[model samples]
Target: MIKSVNCTSFKIERLQTDNGAEFKNTFLSTFLEGCGNIHETSIPYEHHQNGNIEWMDCSISEISQTMLIASCLPKELWPYAFCHAAWIFNRTMHGNDTIAPYEVIAKNKPSLLLLCVFGSKGYLYDHLFQKDLSEKAIFGYHLGEAPHSKGWLFWIPDRKKVLKGASVKFDKNCFIQRIPASTSSLSLIQASSIFDGSMILAIEKQDKLVSSVNVSHDPIHVTPINYREALASAEANEWNIAIEEELTSIN
Candidate 1:
């Protein structure tokens, strides 16, 4: 939940839960109150208001089940599998719509060159190296895209670790479909930019710009225009003689 809040651009104005004792605790209530957000409780049996979250949870459960059966991976690794699932979902086209969520937000279609087959084996080079000695790389699964950059993401199988916020460089010649021995561990990764109130405001501004442009008929032309071509015919006549003289000299 903290990670979700950290990654998203929207502020959670309130958190409404059921009359479950876990949520009704004094400490949790005090925390919510101190955060200056409303905390409302719904009736124990009625689930209509919380329908959205309920549906989302069910969907995740279904996806996890399918992935587990297809990949033969354990349930403990479902969280990592779900991250790859989300990346695929964000990139795939849906029902009569050619554009994906990534395209809509970035205003350009992202290339799939960075994508790797999920669960496929790959190698990840460690960041550090010893003097006059060749450093070793770890064997891992080619997961998906880096959340913050235009690169492939990997999950080191030997170490049972997921490499976040880092790019992968594939060795096409020696690529295989199995994990290898673990090497020296790499440094901990961090997000390049943290989500803040100001960044959320900026995203809102971008949304407005996209919405405004979507409704217009005129194409937003970004190509550079030649000054000579842009000039009126009458105005261009003044420069015609100069051009003619230059051409004649070449002839």
Candidate 2:
């Protein structure tokens, strides 16, 4: 969970969880204590205390399940569908918010250029295992976005494995019929329309559960944005020495 937000500048000061046995364990308690963080639990039998998270969980489940039903994919591929659902959830606007959660964290709007219909048929370049005379590209099903990458994940039925590929072409109009299912009842809009603008307030309330962890005596280091700032910073002497060394090496 910590790794999920490592890309951002947010510092986690507290953790809130339900009174599950997994969260009440000694190791987790000790870990939080070591990090000088607080751990709080929701009151027993009060589901409203966790309304935002509960609602989000339900939305993700519905979206993923809907994708599975539409794609006619097996239940075993639900993990990939969940990943795709989360990717979409982050990119999409929630409630009445003008900006997405991803925009808040990433400081920019997400690009939808690479997004395609779930279970869309595509061909992935097989540079790694391609024989001299074999086909360079192989057929596959669109899975989801690759973690920490700009590529997409593809499920090659022939190889029976999921492969990450950068260069690929998707046929948005074509969907694999590995398993046929009725997609009449499934709709992505249902997930987005379930909650109103009030849910944003509930999510903001949940944000109070986390805070910045900083000590008074700890010195904060701010990176210099430009050469002038670097010369005027507290480490100006070190910067000057480095600059002189670089000039000397160039000479």
Candidate 3:
């Protein structure tokens, strides 16, 4: 599948694989070589040699399995399941570097405006509605992220819609599987309160005693903020200090 996509885009470069029977045939080697591509084989029994592909496959498998269990989806649709898995995984930030794969590749934070809870109830708008269409919304499982658009991929069982795009809604009751199983072991570090200087610390302090650290100064608030609230909270400390000074002067 990957080979087909690569061939279509004329981006076929080095095709690396383990010493498997699939790529051992002379025909496969000749075809790849004819396309001016290098077919490199990794060392036998040494999985670390092909760490990149190995890691990717493991990530996909883990995510797909989790989604399948969560949604009770069948095995035949594992391809779609993995696509959804890959999309979400890409959106997630890596623990080692604190950078999402999408951001790393695209060089920007992905917009979650169209993100919705996985396995949530949503209404699919029907275009061909002559009479008053009372029942528009259908029950669906929020699978993952979308490929082409800024929308949540929903699996609507009622309408038999698979991989449907929908708007993002933040309801407490919504069943969202935003936490992918592959990243379950990963830990997110929350920045603590900033001190007098611009030094930042994690909410959970590390045992290691480092002389100095340069943590991310970026704000990490997750709630959807209105313009007024956002502007007001921009200088949180300044507002508090000003209020304190006013009270002190009055007293």
lDDT of 1 at 97: 82
Q: What is the lDDT of candidate 1?
A: 0.54
Could you tell me every candidate's TM-score relative to the true structure? Answer: 0.47, 0.67, 0.52
Q: Which scores better on lDDT, 1 or 3?
A: 1
* Residue pairs in collision within model 3: 118-142, 119-141, 119-142, 123-137
Q: Which scores better on TM-score, 2 or 3?
A: 2
Of the pair 1 and 3, which is ahead by TM-score?
Answer: 3
Instruction: Give the per-residue lDDT of model 3 (tens digit) for 100-145.
Output: 8778656679776655443444554443343674554444555666
* Model 1: colliding residue pairs: none
Ranked candidates (TM-score, high to low): 2, 3, 1
Shift in Å, residue 87, candidate 2? 1.1
In order, what lDDT does every prediction score? Answer: 0.54, 0.70, 0.53
lDDT of 2 by residue, 58-126 (tens): 798789988987886555666789879999999999999999989988888899977877888899998
RMSD to the hidden true structure, all candidates: 25.5, 21.2, 22.9
What TM-score does candidate 1 get on C-alpha atoms?
Answer: 0.47
Residue 128 displacement (Å), model 2 = 3.1
